[model samples]
Target chain A: MMEFLQQRLTDLELFGWDEYINYWFFLAMMALFAFELIVMAFKKAVTWNLIGDSITNFITLFAYRFIGGLIYILFYLTAFFWVYENFSITQLPLTWMSLLGCILLADVIYYWEHRFMHVCGLGWATHTVHHSSPHFNISVAYRFGPLDGFFPFFFHLPLIMLGFHPFMVFLAEALVQLYQTALHTQMVKKLPRPIEYIMNTPSHHRVHHATNSKYIDKNYAGIFIIWDRMFGTFAEEDEKVKFGVYPRINSVNPFTVFFHGFTKLGKQLWEAPSWSYRFQLLIRPPIWAWEQEQKRKREAAAAEAKASP
Target chain B: MNFFVSALSTILLGLVVGFALSLQKAEPPTEFEKYSSANMDFATMSEVGYAMAAFGRESTADYFELKDYQEYVQLAQNDHAKALSASDSPQVAASEAQASKAEAPTMQLAQVEHPAKPKAKPSLKDWPKSVIGIQRSTELINVEKVWQEFASNSALSDQLDSYTVSVFAIYSDFNSDYSRATISIGYDKPSMKGEQQLIPKGKIETLLKPSNYGNNALLNAWQDIDYSKAVKAVVERRDYTQNSELTSLFVIYQ
Candidate 1:
């Protein structure tokens, strides 16, 4: 059993290690909820904001983790058996430089995947579920769309083959995630200016969820803020940014939350005027669709008024 | 008042949880905890020492394909020590004299060839030699295939008229001395029937190849096994020559 497990641990890389940390982290998350329920007693409404969101989101995330881990183990095992035995794909140099390169490249991909979830149409579909509840707190941070499971992390096969020990990579990814989880709470509002500049913050994440113009679509970082800043995706939360999207999907059904993006993707593609519009509907910014529809409505109103007058 | 009560209740619950976790800290498997990596710091013997204590029903996976059926042949408990000694037990020497030169009981020969083959034991000066010989290939039986032929012809045991017993896959080189592994078989007892039985280590036959195994490329996907299953700890042990082929061994352990 130890032999079997050692191979798995070595194979799980940092991912397994992150799970190691998460066991304790999961305990910590539960303890916070305990404090909220037993000490503050949920009646203290503000605590609910964090505790409520966190508990609900965490339960869902936990379910996904259980299911996802089970499924991925099958895939990872099949892949492991074939590749570890037959191939010498440890082609990537296992030096610190290579490790650094793999991790940074992964972060780069993650930053964009995250950014795309915020832009409207796509945002309304996938990212809005997170902002759906009328709550913002540590637990809210735990709430993620089930669709988020098909993340870039699973797609990182080439990176593993490139020389990253899947184990170490998993650890790095989990640490990055754990770090992100720490930022979800309203408890910590600000840090030193230098830290704020480089890291994603509750302040920045608050902005990303904000309906406020200045704040929307800003401050997307997993472990580093430089990705967002470099890509001009950074927005600072100044005014109290309203959470949740306008003309919200408004459904509490988690099923809706899961498929809202997919539904919107289909809707935008179908209702689009031209092939390019359709293509853009699928790929372009959310604002483009809104602008085009607004123009069409104004022209139709004018035509009606002129004929009647 | 409600807030205070909640806090007190939670603190109590936490204490209970801590107690439960602490209680679980005691158990035999704690040393084996964290299957991903056993605490090798406490390991003094070769890595195989870890395998002997391998436990828990969860560990059937580590066991190989269940060639499930097992049969035990009990010799007199007294012969156990004799059976364990190098094959030159007085019983064996007497048995060999009654047997053929080609089939001589060379169970204690120090040479690599069949001791019964009209050859003298090779001098230690000729050690490090690679000789191709067969290991015991089947399950253990008190009546060996070679011995069965002799005993039946001699009509030694009255039961031999209908006696059909299994042959243990052990190769005794009347010539060269060989190394051996010890094995233990568990005896499950029912409340009402079938007395508990003692099973000896079934001989696992190894094929001798001229090529010896190297330090680096020994076996693929082989895990460290528990080396201390010695029900009758044979002092014999075996290692490899320079270029041993991977499939050169076929074995059955009792």
Candidate 2:
């Protein structure tokens, strides 16, 4: 069965079927999203803000794709090829087994990379754009930040060094991404217990996007929810889930949504008292940085009052 | 300011302690270390012998004579004696050296004549009309005969004058027997600038004939390779000059 599947994949690749799969799948999803809008309109849920937000999501997607393409062509591919050619311990043959292993490992790496984006201040500065949307829908999946494409290089480069071909790693990454894209919806409430436990369903991903205190920094899985369970980041959908980021940017304007994270970070850095504190703001968690900023403001106010007295 | 000074002082103190610790005497070599050192010496000697043979010079037997062997033994004994003397055991060192000499049998050195000059590099003019180079691991297979067979087709041979025809067969793994392979043929206009500047004539997805793998060791290893695999092989173009005749070709596998 494995050999048969491998041969089928090879045939599809030979016929260039895999190249056009993404475009076709995207068109199908867009159709589904349009149907969803019509359904929401019937239910009196469609608003101008929702429409603007979806448009902004697409704009961010285009920007991400443009920047991501430049980075991939100029840096990512070059680095991946160099590391694979020079440092790879062994070249794994193209087979069903190896491809499966690459996908599994790539998914695990995605979990950690996703977690990093939520925890690290710099990472949150970029990732916050995706989570900034108040509404969860298919269009929300398309929302991306400027450096979203760039950070994956750090996580996936090791796959190339581990002997999986760069192309194989790329395919694995795309599969993981595509799987997650389908989960950015509220239509599917839950699934069978086995699948819900094993896979990253819409319910699990909804919790991931939730900004509620209980759901903050939870469900960082890509294709498998097992990673979150194993890593102690897993949370079940028990309560009402709130979407969007904390201290929201409050704008559907594409430029505002795209640059807000970096602008906010820059403001914090400028407000920081010292170079050491500024550096700490970059590496520390977003919550810690926020707390530190509040502390700094209090200290500054107290010092000003004392000087005046 | 206080923090900076303390940090600097701590770093300086750490450096001094590290340097002092590094200057301390090393422990005696372990049995594994001695074995590894002896193995390395043997490997070095073997490499020298291989290098000489590869360059068409004398073999290892002709290179190391009885006199040279005796001289090496004498040098080793002298070094051992110096070490023993440093330990204030000169009498024991002398007795050991005497015993070593007694164990050595008297042998005559064989007179051998050395080559007067090094061999010259092969002229590019001697290069074949079509060159097929296969690189796999440390082995490089240059099959002029295979190239001749390929050039037998008038259509392919015609491109030799204006375009550099490159046939690249890429394998998924080093062990090609069980791996997948993909073959591509690229035609590039010969130019001096670089591969990037070359005007691509065309490219064709092709397959190598089974007969091509008959004699070549590298290709034979790839006999069972699956040609259905998807791979993109890089094409490398190189220029060869002999007198006024300039022959340009693409080195498919480097």
List, for all models, the DockQ compared with the true complex. 0.03, 0.01
Instruction: Report, to 2 decimal places, the DockQ of model 2.
Output: 0.01
What is the lDDT for B92 in model 2?
45
Instruction: Give residue B191's lDDT in candidate 2 (0 to 100).
Output: 28
Candidate 2, A221-267: lDDT as tens digits: 99999978876789999898989998977899999999999999999
For model 2, what is the error of residue A239's alpha carbon versus the real structure, in angstroms, after optimal superposition? 1.0
Tell me the lDDT of candidate 2: 0.61
Error of 1 at A108 (Å): 2.9
